[model samples]
Target: MDEGRPIFQQIAERVENDILSGALVEEGQVPSTNEFAMFYRINPATAGKGVNLLVEQGILYKRRGIGMFVATGARERITARRRELFVLEYVAPMLAEAASLGIEPDQLGQLITDQLTAGRLSEKETR
Candidate 1:
């Protein structure tokens, strides 16, 4: 966990990462607040705050007696939300930088393609 962000946000992001990676499926039971607290060595209230954030976002739901479970279509919903965030967080800033550098759209496209291709090639070589 980075010291820069709140622990609760980090906990929420951990669950999001799990859902995106298929480790946590829709309708699956999530770790209880106590479980999270024990695992992370944090307070139960802090863990509960993270879990509640997901509940508010419709990512998780609770049964009266049972624990929280991942909501149906949570992955799809999260993916869509993250895509929008990616555009705002990454793409917009990249485009702005490219414009400031006087890079045309086509030039920026080619640069991105080249970088992607190089990365793929390097990965293959490492393997």
Candidate 2:
């Protein structure tokens, strides 16, 4: 993540990506705010901010005595939310940039697809 982006936003996005990708599933437990703070060596307040972002988005739910858990529809909700953000933030700008650079949208998309495929294959091979 770019340093210019807020740290809380980055942390929130990371957790959201994990949930969307099924690393964090519906009804599954998530690390506590303090745990996240310790794990990332950041202030607990920062971690809480990230976690609270998820809570506000209906991604994580409190369990009374227990820690936070992913919401029942969290995976789908995360996916849809990200898809919405991608269109509004990533896709539109990238399309505009492609036009500005005289690069075909299909070509740029192919490059991204190739890079992602190669990245996954490399990760699998290494594992």
Best by lDDT: 1
1-127: candidate 1 lDDT, tens digit per residue: 6899999999999999999999998999999999999999999999999999999999999988899999999999899999999999999999999999999999999999999999999999999
Clash counts per candidate, in order, are 0, 0
User: Over all chains combined, what TM-score does candidate 2 have?
Assistant: 0.73
In the predicted model 1, the residue pairs found to clash are none
lDDT of 2 by residue, 28-89 (tens): 99999999889888888988998999899898889988999989988887778778988999
Considering every candidate listed, which one attains the maximal TM-score? 1
lDDT per prediction? 0.95, 0.87
Residue 109 shift from truth in candidate 2, angstroms: 10
